[model samples]
Target: MRGVDVLSTAFKNAFRSRLRTSLTVLAIFIGAFTLSLTNGLGTGINQYIDDTVASVGVDDVMTVTKASEEEPTDGPAEYDPNQIAADGAPGATATALTDDDIDTIAGIDGVESVEPSKSVMVDYVRHDDGTRYQLSVAEFVPGMRIELVSGEQVDLDASDPELVLPESYVEPLDLGSAADAVGQTVVLAVTDATGEQVTTEATVVGVAEPGVLTMGGAVPNDVLAAELYDLQTTGAPEAETTRYAEASVSFDTSGGATQTEALQDRLADAGFTGSTLEDQLGTITAVIDGIVLVLNGFAVIALVAAGIGIVNTLFMAVQERTREVGLMKAMGLSSGRVFSLFSIEAVVIGLVGSALGVLGAVGAGQLVNGVSGDLLADLPGLTLIAFDPVGVATVVLGVMAIAFLAGTLPALRAARQDPISSLRYE
Candidate 1:
């Protein structure tokens, strides 16, 4: 028989035992549906992480800090006056990066430049007669990208002190709306040295959406941060004001990963620790991927069970069609052709079941995505379940391959039957 003729005949025969074939197909459907959903979950989360990494960090910049040589003891050790408050936060001290350390880092190979990291603390923010709300402001870094709800990102080079308000702060601060807050003035009060209150006013340049990097804090440009830092340190010793907990080092990006590692090694040799954005966020991605892998294991187990069902279904079909096989052999059909016929039937069943499963998964994923979009409305640009065409295709083809393999034994038994003996038995 021609290939087309054989394929058509096999498809027709596949549903002869309707209930049995349906049960076997249902098993395969369960496995395919599960596999597709798990893959979609992984794709969606990883995509969101990729976008967040791009928006939050710069690839060519590394955050460098002086590594603490003092080992941890059972109790607090004697305080060293040389150590400064880390990030300028009260009660937190660390080995501060001084002017000498900055010069040493600049002299290191492959470093383009270094900027002292500043941590600005704002006591409270008040707009007009609105209530005073405690506000945490994050320092701005060059080349940083932030997702904005309205207006534009803070400009570090701008002469005036500019700040971006977080979405959560708008209503509480009585800023009206995100758009209305732009270009408005807000007062920030900070306590200077000698325990005196100091107030600084900054214009709102933009409003930012809630994000991983912002951590519910306001974002301040260089001018705003420098102004706040200066106010907070007024009347303090000049030597103490210059001390910093860390620095931002910009490096050559053309060298890629090898160059990045070399620069980090050089920093380590200088008694400093340098970490790129990937180093800081790698643990998050690793944990996410690991969870997806575990979930996939369960789907694979279901597929294996489905494979066994395919084997049993084909074996029964072979037994029930023993006479038909003998009659076909009695005609001009060859053993190879008989084998091909049975294999095609198995493939046809796999195609039907897998197609339905993939379609069903797509439907379910869309529904979940819609529901999650509302539930996670605060997290813009996130899809909870997203399907990739290539991944879905891989699942369908994999299930069909398993079905073909399971039919092999049955096809072989039919091929080996002796025509004269099989025809006389019934």
Candidate 2:
């Protein structure tokens, strides 16, 4: 028979048992829709995590102080006065990282760039309004994650004290407009390495967009440090100045697993032991992927139930058509034709159901995203609900394949019917 004639025959047969055909198609649609939703949600979540990590410059690694090997010293007897506080006991000491450490790490094979930064907690006040905030701040190391949104970045060697503020902090202080805040003076109260509250003034040189703060709240670090030095010291002049205890190192290329291992070895050789951001993210992604795999597996149970429905429906169709199969054979239709007709009908049901399933999944995804927008508005990362064409295609094809397989046995049974016996018995 021609393709058009076969299709027409298939449609006539389906229409003769409209309720059964409808139920079979509905089963396929539900299965395909559920599969699409699960796959799309998983893809969206992974994309969100990747974007969040990228925003933070996940390629960089930070080196901080390790636990001390030496035991605590007693009495001030052998202690260096510079290392001891006025109380004569060991004072609050900072990490020993210095330019020498930077030089050592920079020499590592994979290292592309390194920036040293230090942070201290302090009290800050607006010069004009005198409003105070307990601020933790760090200095700008040029060519780092923090980018200047207004004005210029602080000059590394400039004598004048300049500062940057987190964009979020700008509105609360009424720092005028972005332009107005530039060149304005703000006062910072901070403790030096020796631990004394010192206050000094600095120009608001720039502002950073939100999500860029690495260590603490979004106060400008350079301004805080310079201001602390300007404040008059109440104690002896010989007090040690606080230094940055760590450095952020960025590589030229994405090292993936191999690069991470090489970088860790280099860091260990330089006498620093700390976790890489990439390694931590890898661990997190692995855990999340495992959880998703398990959840997807459970969801597949629904699809299996729908598959079983398809099998049962086809089996019933075969039983109903036994005498029809005998008539077709006596009318000169071959066994192959009889089988082809039923198989074609099954495929038609699957195709139509899969198309509807795609529509349903797309609509559901959009609804979910609309409702979730408000909850995710303040979040720094990508949203988790999304429509992915590849994932939709995969689900549709998978359901259709399952449907075709479910109909196979019934098609074979209908084809193998003995024409004379089927007509005589029924």
Highest-scoring model, TM-score: 1
Clashing pairs in 1: none
Q: What is the C-alpha local distance difference test score of candidate 1?
A: 0.86
- Candidate 2: residue pairs that collide: 138-221
The TM-score that candidate 1 achieves is 0.83
Model 1 agreement with the true structure over 216-326: per-residue lDDT tens digits: 789888888889999999998988788888899999889989999999999999999898878877767788879988987898799879888888988888888888899
- What's the residue-level lDDT of 242 in candidate 1? 80
TM-score of each: 0.83, 0.67
Expressed as tens digits, the lDDT of each residue in 122-191 for candidate 2 is: 5665557656765556544443455455876665566776667765666667787777777888776765
Of candidate 2, the 10-residue stretch with the lowest lDDT total is 80-89
Residue-pair clashes per candidate? 0, 1
